[model samples]
Target: MRSMTRRNRLMAAIKYLVCAIMILVIAVPLYISVMGGLKSVGQLRAEPVSLPNPVNWNQYTDMLTGKNGSFWPKLVNSVVIGLGTVGVILIIGTFAGYALARIKFKLNGLIYAYFQLGLLFPLAVAILPLYLQLRSFHLLDSAIGVILPQAAFGLAMMLMLLRGFIKAIPLELEEAAAIDGYSRFGFLFRIVVPLSTPILATVSVLTLVSSWNNFFTPLLVFNSEKKYTLPMGVMNFMGEHAADWNLILAYLTLAMIPAVIIYVLCQKYIVAGLTGGAIKG
Candidate 1:
């Protein structure tokens, strides 16, 4: 009994130590970015790790207030692209998920497998083909260019998550609705969708973060500075503000806030969605 107790205590200590290490790994970078942004360029150079003596708010406020038409426009572009990608993925993924999970049909397994194949491949491999397709369609340098490819790449994961979640729904509920004369669409919208809120939130948060932080795709697609998304804009900003570490950190910090806010708010749903979606469809 004493040996077992000692072993459990050792295991618990190890787990706590691991958790603390992970927290430090994540928190240290965020602390540097925030505090670095609050310092002046000279102060950042001199006392890189020390807290700001006289906090400099201008780096953030100046950009937000349109001092140079840099940060806000890029933020807006990110919002538009992120929302557009989410909209397309949700509309298409939900129906596809429902059909794959609930409706019995020929080639359903094949079709589902086709989407699953997408998960096996990374988008980088197909960038050349995707870029050519976009160019052919005259979609280059447009939000549509970014949105379509992002949605296509993201669809597979979203569908899988939603399908697993939908399959977990009680079939008796669908039959009960059918007995009440509910149409398929009605049952889906009223019943399945409402019940799949956690998964939906999961997909939304994931899509938003992916779209918001997307750099390579936007860099390849958007040729014009005016249409540059936040990630692209931040890169360009970094180039211009290369000498000013504080300003660069400020841009990076602001660019990260929205996605961070979203994840923080939907963290509970993320956990639930991931766990629930792990069940086989």
Candidate 2:
């Protein structure tokens, strides 16, 4: 009995240690970024690790007020693209997911396999071809250009997640609805979607984060200053002659806030959605 008790205690201690290490790993960088953002360029250079000797709000002030550049417009552009991409993903992915989950068709498995294959194709591999296609359509510097590719890349994952969730929902519900005279579209929008809110929220949050943090796609497609996304615009803070580390960190700090807010707000749904479909389907 004593041995078993000792072993359990030791395991608990180890778990606590692991948790503490994980927290430190995550928190340290975030702390550094926030504190670094509050420091001036000189303070950052002089005392890299120390707390700002005199807190400098200029980094944030300059960015927000557009003294350095039009940070607000860049932020607005990011919001537009990110939200637009999520809207497209949700509308299209929900229906596609419902079909994959419930509707039977020839070679449906093969079609799904192709969608899954997209996950394997790294973004780098398709960048060149995607650039050519976008240029041909005159979409190279447009928000629509960014939105379409982001939605396309996200659809596979969204469909995969939502399909599993939708499948987990009992088919009897749909049958009952059908007997009550609910049309196909009606059943989907009215019944399936309501039940799948958890997963929908999850997918929405994930899509928002992915679209917001998209640097490479925006970099390749959007060259105009007016159309710059947050991630791409952060690069502009770095000058060729000298990079402003404090300002760059401030931009990064600001960039991360919206994603964090969305995640925290919807994390409960994300968890429920992920687990609700695992084996129930």
Residues 26-111 of candidate 2 have per-residue lDDT tens digits of 99899889889999888888887788879989888887788776678988999999899989999988988888899999977888
For model 1, residues 1-281, the per-residue Cα lDDT tens digits are: 99999999999999999999999999889988998988998898898888997999988888788894388889899999999999999999999999999999999999999999888889999999889999999999999999999999998889888887799999999999999999999999999999988789888988888898888789889999999999888889888877888888888898889878977887886666556555543
The superposed Cα distance between candidate 2 and the true structure at residue 122, in angstroms, equals 2.2
Alpha-carbon local distance difference test for all models: 0.89, 0.84
The weakest ten consecutive residues by lDDT in model 1 span: 272-281
Which residue pairs clash in candidate 2?
none
Candidate 2 achieves a global lDDT of: 0.84
- After superposition, candidate 1 runs with Cα above 4 Å error: 1-22, 273-281
